[model samples]
Target: MPQHSPLDLAEGDPFGPHNLPYGVFTTSDEPQRRRVGVRYGAYVLDVHALAEAAGSAHAAVLSAGTLNPLLAAGRAIWSAVRAELVDALTDPARRVTVEPLLVPLADVALHLPFDVADYVDFYASEHHASNVGQIFRPNGDALTPNWKHLPIGYHGRAGTVVVSGTPVVRPAGQRKAPADAAPTFGPSQRLDIEAELGFVVGTPSTLGEPVPLDAFADHVFGVTLLNDWSARDIQAWEYVPLGPFLGKSFATSVSAWVTPLDALAHARTAPPRRDVPLLPYLDDSAAAEPGGFDIRLEVAINGHVVSRPPFSAMYWTAAQQLAHMTVNGASLRTGDLFASGTISGPRPEERGCLLELTWSGRDPVELPTGKRTFLEDGDEVTITAWAPGPDGVRVGLGEVTGKITGR
Candidate 1:
């Protein structure tokens, strides 16, 4: 269990001492240069000031506007800095020094924490994949032949990835009906959201080296909520030869705060059994260690709660994905982000997106705003999550929310 900080955190506070998540922010006082900060309760701790006050070696990096430098410092420095932060907040003697650096979170605007070098979205949830397969290919097997054998993934448009609360313009692409003689170009009719958890690479790797499963936490800094917006109708037309393109590249939203892997130690759970034999590279020998997290995730449309997807139900573990990604000797950068696909659970109520919940447009969900076959203009979708904390407490990953606008 984690010790209490000087700040009096509420019962379910996500930014407690145990979870001093990092982000970049700009206050009205100084909006020119973004500053690095740590979330604690409803306040943001000035990382640079805190580092200087504590006379820590990381002060220079903390003073920067983004987390990339700190991320590039590797695991040793990350551990040292986190330890210093824990002491600064929890130690009674440091109260006077730390108090001055605390700023109310509402007073600052959060920015993207790191510059994204690359982005990869993986289809790792069995229930979500099964549901999508069933809806799209009813005559085919729900589980693809190679799904259980490997983590299916695709490189995404990292440049277009936006922070939470950014408005998403409905994507426009060519769509053709079965009876239509030609494809029509218009704004997407079936805009949807995929609730996912994203992992950030902290340490870069060599070009010809593969990161082992045991070193998962050593390289990954933290996790955040991600919404991979999709266009179903456009995807249906173009995804035959290659996977998602314009249907997926328009915009993806992510929460600003990044909860470190250290904070989620208590939330880890064992993954489900695998159906296929694993290759040596994809082997998960850390069976006793946590392969999944018992994070309870929820999705809402226009303030109405609609789905509760469980992160623990994901078929492929983060460790496995990391190893598989590097098995081909692909190098990693400090800001590489890989996300778990829509994390739907085994039940109807747990579907992650409108596509599965509506059975591929056959069923429409009735929201308080109105019936939604797919998202309509002005409709905002938000995804939030909470995981088990030490001593039965709960820690949260704030949220990733976006509203749809006409293109």
Candidate 2:
């Protein structure tokens, strides 16, 4: 829990020695070959150098330009590497060897840490789900019949998943207004942002076997901030029998750094009690323990802070989602990502997206420059998260940010 380190880290630095989150980076000087790096203060440690100097096999695995290789290596190697890095950073004698390899974060360009295998997005937050259900289905009950029994999710577009800072082109799709007799195709007018937390799957599982709740830490390598972009007008017309498609598949932004499950030891907390009994397969025993994280997630537009969604407010846990995902005999592959969709708390200010915050575009959110019901062209949306670190410092998941540009 000590905050002491050989590096000149600030007292409340999010990427202090306590948090050696992994990332993929390439500098302006060396842009051809991507290398694995770890965030420490304002510098990124060249993990390839750490691998090479130690002559560890982890070097070749981590040096593959993506975190996928190291992810497949599983928990044992992950623990070993993290421990070794912590020791190296803490050791005064090792400073000389480590200093030469440290690259200032300002000089490097961060890329997506891993190649996505499959993407699944789950609507796990009770507050967010309720808000959405009420707005969309005003005459019907807020929650669906089977909502409490299982974690509801759908497969997302893995091919469209982009790293932070990527420009989100406004999607041109079909939309029919209430008064319109026919649907029209054009650029989306109701573009929005969904603040989310993404779980990165590391180890692959058998095709017929399900990943149990206990295997969450073993299967899921790390967590990252995610922004699931939405086109409301396109979605409202198409989402009748089926769920989100072109309205959502446009672009989903993810943070550059992946904060390992090992670093989030202190952030665990219990979720709210379930009102209904879950099926045996979905009834994870980890629920008796603290299955939720106390991560404070924020959604911002332009330069204004709009909402603060708490991750702990989710109805279902991440472990439960993982268990339900593979319970149908579907296998997990390395780089498989599953996101906790739109984390929202009980308060009005805790809404995760503009849909809820503006009440389905009925109310406009007041800002310094102007009021907004939804994102306008050239609007930049940023999502960031942080939790209590080892000491008084905070451990950040970094930010997933993107700008809306006209097609």
Candidate 3:
């Protein structure tokens, strides 16, 4: 028999009882300073309250103040927290520490789990880059020279990172059509969204210390849905010898729950390879040892949103990204972020973002009702994920959604 979380997890559930991913949450009437909790079924199990109940079991670690403190304690403590919660909250036999913290996932508002110390968005998906490159530079190479040697990445603004539900105010920026023409300042007219996934680093690695591939799992705390809101016109004008500046800075949204790596352990599968041979550090085993996670990711638009299907079309895995991040000895603090840029597959139907789906505004996607071409006012974008199926259903990250309000 397969080992599973104590909870009744179906074959493809990502948050089965075995996985107690952490996050911060607050109610409509609660404070902005959040509390820790785990996702199970459709509820957020408040860990603080649970710790108070499991006094002896959660004693040593719970006294550390916040999940951030304990997260810094290393993987042993992480395992203990997850194990204790599974026994106490998921099982009725050990339900003594389970009351007072049970909040309906639907009722509460979720926040970014931790303060992101740093944000590094990587263009690690080969297919996505190729497709995009072909569209832009068809007569030339599909990928840049440096892309094959290392994980192409850019540092993003941590301050602009917001929780999923937070309203994404349309950003104001500069747009330049031709160098000959002076740039204009105004609210972004070409507002767009990029579907991405990022892993939260748990354990810290000092400056100049390389995080090896095998140990990448221990360094990763969990996964979250990321909607990298983009200003195409702005990004194009400023992003050159220097990458994304004001255009990609305004705001980035992430889902609340930290989907544990343990939950998706069974879903590992290697991504399709390309013709080029990867660099030594960026080898096959580093990307996908036997296989890495294959969680199905989805996206939707508006309240009566039309949802796209799931596909794990990432060119590189989180582990590989983590290893690459610290390859040059860059320190990875507890709240650091690493994003899998725009997950797009070979098929048009599997496209992950509006730029690709709409083919850079050339073809607009027809909603169930009508209208399309990038996002519009009152339009909401939602990103969701799970292992697969409904049998041993694990706690899902739910959905990270934002509406485009008029500037």
- TM-score, per-candidate, Cα-based: 0.97, 0.97, 0.89
> Compared with the true structure, what per-residue lDDT tens digits does model 1 show for residues 346-404?
99999999999999789999897788989999999999998988887777788999999
Position 272, candidate 1: lDDT: 85
Candidate 3: where is the Cα deviation over 4 Å?
Answer: 1-15, 28-33, 57-66, 178-180, 286-288, 303-311, 389-395
Stretches > 4 Å off in candidate 2: 1-6, 285-288
Compute the lDDT of residue 311 as modeled in candidate 2: 94
lDDT of 1 at 134: 91
Candidate 1, residue 261: Cα displacement in angstroms equals 0.3
lDDT of 1 at 16: 83
Model 1 misplaced regions, further than 4 Å: 1-6, 286-288
- Per-candidate total of colliding backbone pairs: 0, 0, 10
Model 3 C-alpha lDDT per residue in residues 101-188, reported as the tens digit of each score = 6777777776677778899898877778887888778899988887767778899999998888888888888898756469899888
lDDT of each: 0.90, 0.90, 0.74
By lDDT, the better pick of 1 and 3 is 1
Clashing residue pairs for model 2: none
lDDT of 1: 0.90
